[model samples]
Target chain A: DAGITQSPRHKVTETGTPVTLRCHQTENHRYMYWYRQDPGHGLRLIHYSYGVKDTDKGEVSDGYSVSRSKTEDFLLTLESATSSQTSVYFCAISAVSGSYEQYFGPGTRLTVT
Target chain B: DQQVKQNSPSLSVQEGRISILNCDYTNSMFDYFLWYKKYPAEGPTFLISISSIKDKNEDGRFTVFLNKSAKHLSLHIVPSQPGDSAVYFCAASAGDKVIFGPGTSLSVIP
Candidate 1:
């Protein structure tokens, strides 16, 4: 119910290609995060941004990159997509860095063949 | 290693009955704990949360019980409904970072 939105809700692409996912929020929250959901593994954080131009890696940041150029947008990029990168990606926004709640976007499903 | 663990992979409860989901954590220094519910094909939504200083917190039909001494927590849904059927994930946070458990699928038989 948060104003978070993710672009390219569904996509099928070939391996070794560059892919970027976008997260936009209307709430103007300070924290935005990217996570990939997989079976049995739950959801793993790939990267997060605390503020515009400020970003950090997460537990499963390997082979993934992210950038936040504006307060409303956070982008997750796969330098070169791999089959292993195929998963449902979610974007989240929190009002503060240490807040207990974070609102999530619908999600983006990407498949790498 | 997983900092948070949801031992049960799935659970079933009859409609209008109580549904109890359990979670255990390895780290004693976690500052906060949270529960999230996810429907198929959708991102997770925050259901409830409790701080380390609190033992219990409640909202509507949902309540979270935290036992710091045992490094455990539990979520209880009273009079469970079909809409409550979803995958539940328990997460722990230390400062600004948080870690998630594998998730437990809950089915409410209506």
Candidate 2:
């Protein structure tokens, strides 16, 4: 286990509502990423942060936003959730030296009605 | 366009047999490759990885082989057990940024 935790392990919300998922890491890794897992899509990177206040868009960055004010925490927000956004969200952290091996959190299952 | 691709959706193997998972990439700049395994309701865990500089790397029952010229890589698990059943994802990275494949579901039946 990599000292990574994702809050609200399971969440259910109505469509068009705001949703936020939190990821906390005790390892203080420099790179943190938020990904969504769907049945056929595997895990697609939604957004990532290399350092505090430094964020970048991934392949599927639309309808999603992320923020990292400190080294240990990264947050992903869906401004207006949609049925299509329902998926398992995972938070991962990676050290600079390791062979890019990411340590993942348990994951947050989000269902949008 | 997907840079990394895992064409197989699922594979089944008997216990004590060998399971081979394949991945292909279109990017030539990707110098590092890795494999991660995920069980149901759990996040992916790192399995094994190989660098572009080498053709093969092995760890215990798991091995990764990379063919830089062909732009293909494979993960081999020998004496597969039921515990090995999971979705395996292949990823490629040039630096710290990595791109993942769609993943293949592996079932090892006893």
Candidate 3:
């Protein structure tokens, strides 16, 4: 397994509350990504960071925000949670030159009530 | 518009049989493709991948074939086992950013 860990393996929160999920990697890879997995929808990219302070929005960036202040940690925040945001979130990392064989974390299951 | 699409929602195969999963993409510029497998309650794990420069790439019981002209790719798993049951996703990358398909649930019955 890659040295990637997603904190709070499971979380349950009420709607309209703020939520923050953390992803930590020990590999020092240059690319880190946050993705959400829903039934029948597979995994959709929410946001990603190429380096500290350098990030970009993915296809499903709405209602989500991310920050990478250091090489080892990338954080995703939902300002106001909604039932629609309930999904399994995963963090992935890849080397800058490899075939982009992303290594994924165990995932965080977030449920919004 | 979805750049990568896996039309099949689920597929079932008997143990020891061959399993084939299909994926399609509309982007011509995507030069790299990959497959990831995910078990229930777990994150996806890298399975196999092929570069657009080549037609096929194989690893052990897993093989990936890419058809550039047709803009499609497929994954073949021989002698499929019950342990192989999981959801598989197809992904395409232009650079460091990758787009993924909806995914296909594969069930291998013993």
Candidate 4:
């Protein structure tokens, strides 16, 4: 129930197309993260941002990019969408960098045909 | 390689019975552990967490037991209810990075 929301809850796009998912938070937390949920694989971190304009890649950052222009918004972009990139994407916010609990947004489901 | 592992894919418990979910980690440097619950069509939510320094931490009906020597942890839910039926994911953190297990689905039969 944290003040977080993801735009385009559901979408379908063709392969090799550009796609961007947005995450917006109202809690003003300093840390924001993007994760993809897949069957049997659980959740894998794609990218994260510590502060405005500060970002870092995660365990599964391949073929994905993220940016945080403002404290309230974080964006995940796929330069060229692929079938492998189709999954439920979640955005999370945390107050601290490490050893801190995170609040998650509803999620965005994207499909690449 | 998976740093965190949940051996069981699914479990069933009768209402009012105890439900136990287990987790194991390979990293010895992990200093923090957490449990997250996810409902269908929704993102996961933090349920409870415990630091490596402690063996056990309890909050109401939920209790997390950590065995650093065995590199294992378990979450117990007493008097399980239907609302507690969901996929439970165990996570371990080493500094800024956290690894999550595949998740165990729990079905509380009424």
Candidate 5:
């Protein structure tokens, strides 16, 4: 309920194809993060942005990329999807990095065939 | 190695009873811990949190206990209700970096 939204709530795409997921926030947060949730992995960060045009990789950023051109929008892209990339992706925003609670969007369930 | 861990995958508690969920972390640098609850088809929501310097933090029916010496923390809900049934995820933070543990599914039976 922190004014966050994710597009294409549920998506199913074939492996080796390109895919992009979008996260939009109205809170004007300085930090935004993208994460993937698997059965045993919990929530693994894919990437994060401190500000517009400032992006960094996360623990599980092997085959994923992210870009932020504006403060409200952060996009995660899979150049060539794989079966292993199929997971529930969540977008989060925070006023500060770790000092406060992060607000989360609904989530995007991606299934790669 | 996982810096944060939740050993239990599931828990069942009766309505009007207490529900306790546990979490452990291996990092000593972690200075803060938090708990989040999630219902099916939705993202996790912030529940409760505690600072490393404190042993306990309470808010309403929810209480979080931290044992720094043991590198353990737990969340307790009193008089649990069916609406409290959800997956709980624990997280640890060291400044700008935060790590998450695998969640524990809690079912509050009515």
Candidate 6:
């Protein structure tokens, strides 16, 4: 409902293959984040961008990379897919940096075989 | 180790009854807390939040209570409805970082 959309709502990829998920927002928020949700693990942040071209790793950034080329788009890439990486990925946008509510996209369900 | 924890994995409440969800945190630096609700196949939506300086904050049928000394927080939904069934996630923030709990699934039985 926050003008956010994620490409490839569902994806299936084999192990050791390259995969990328896209998050696009029209709200022009200053912060964007990528998270993975797994059973009993909740949501673990993979990476975040505070501003265009400025990004930082999160608690579970291992084996994942992200880039923000403009204010409207943020990308998450898996250099090489793994079975452990299969999970529901969500993208979020917030007007303020911290201590604020974030609007989330529908989410992308990625399966790695 | 998880900085945020939701000990309960599931809960059930009859329609028109009260639903309570609990959360605990280990980090003392957290200054803000929030709750989000998620339905199946959909991303989470913000429910309620409270500042560390406040003990309680209420919005309509939803209320959030924070106990800083205990590092605990809870969300209460009054007169629960079947439509309220979903997964609830509690989150804490410090500086520029925010951590989320494992989430508790609530089933409001009709």
Residue-wise C-alpha lDDT for candidate 5, range A1-113, written one tens digit per residue: 79999998999999999999999999999999999999988888889899999988878999999999999999999999999999999999999885469988999999999
Per-residue alpha-carbon lDDT of model 5 for B1-110, expressed as tens digits?
99999999999999999999999999999999999998989998999989999999999999999999999999999989999999999999987657899999999999
Off by over 4 Å in 6: none
Q: lDDT value for candidate 4?
A: 0.94
Each candidate structure's TM-score, on Cα atoms with residue i matched to residue i, is: 0.98, 0.97, 0.97, 0.98, 0.98, 0.99
Name the lDDT of candidate 3: 0.93
User: How high is the TM-score of chain B in model 2?
Assistant: 0.98
In model 3, which regions exceed 4 Å deviation?
Answer: A97-99
lDDT of each: 0.93, 0.93, 0.93, 0.94, 0.93, 0.95
Candidate 3: TM-score?
A: 0.97
Number of clashes in model 4? 0
lDDT of 4 by residue, A11-100 (tens): 999999999999999999999999999999899889999899999888999999998989999999999999999999999999886467
> Per-residue lDDT for B77 in model 2?
98
- In terms of docking quality, model 4 is medium
Candidate 6 lDDT score at position A34: 95
Worst 10 residues of 2 chain B by lDDT: B91-100
Q: Rank the candidates by DockQ, best first.
A: 6, 4, 5, 1, 3, 2
With a 3 Å backbone cut-off (N, CA, C), the pairs that clash in candidate 6 are none
What is the CAPRI rating of model 3's predicted complex?
medium
Instruction: Please tell me which predicted candidate would have the highest lDDT against the true structure.
Output: 6
Candidate 4 lDDT by residue in tens digits, B1-110: 99999999999999999999999999999999999999999989999999999999999999999999999999999989999999999999887767889999999999
Tell me which of candidates 1 and 2 scores higher on TM-score.
1
Please give the DockQ score of every candidate, comma-separated.
0.70, 0.61, 0.62, 0.76, 0.75, 0.81
For model 1, how does the per-residue alpha-carbon lDDT over A15-98 read when each residue is reduced to its tens digit? 999999999999989999999999898888889888999998899999999999899999999999999999999999999763
Clashes of each: 0, 0, 0, 0, 0, 0
Give me the chain B TM-score of candidate 6. Answer: 0.98
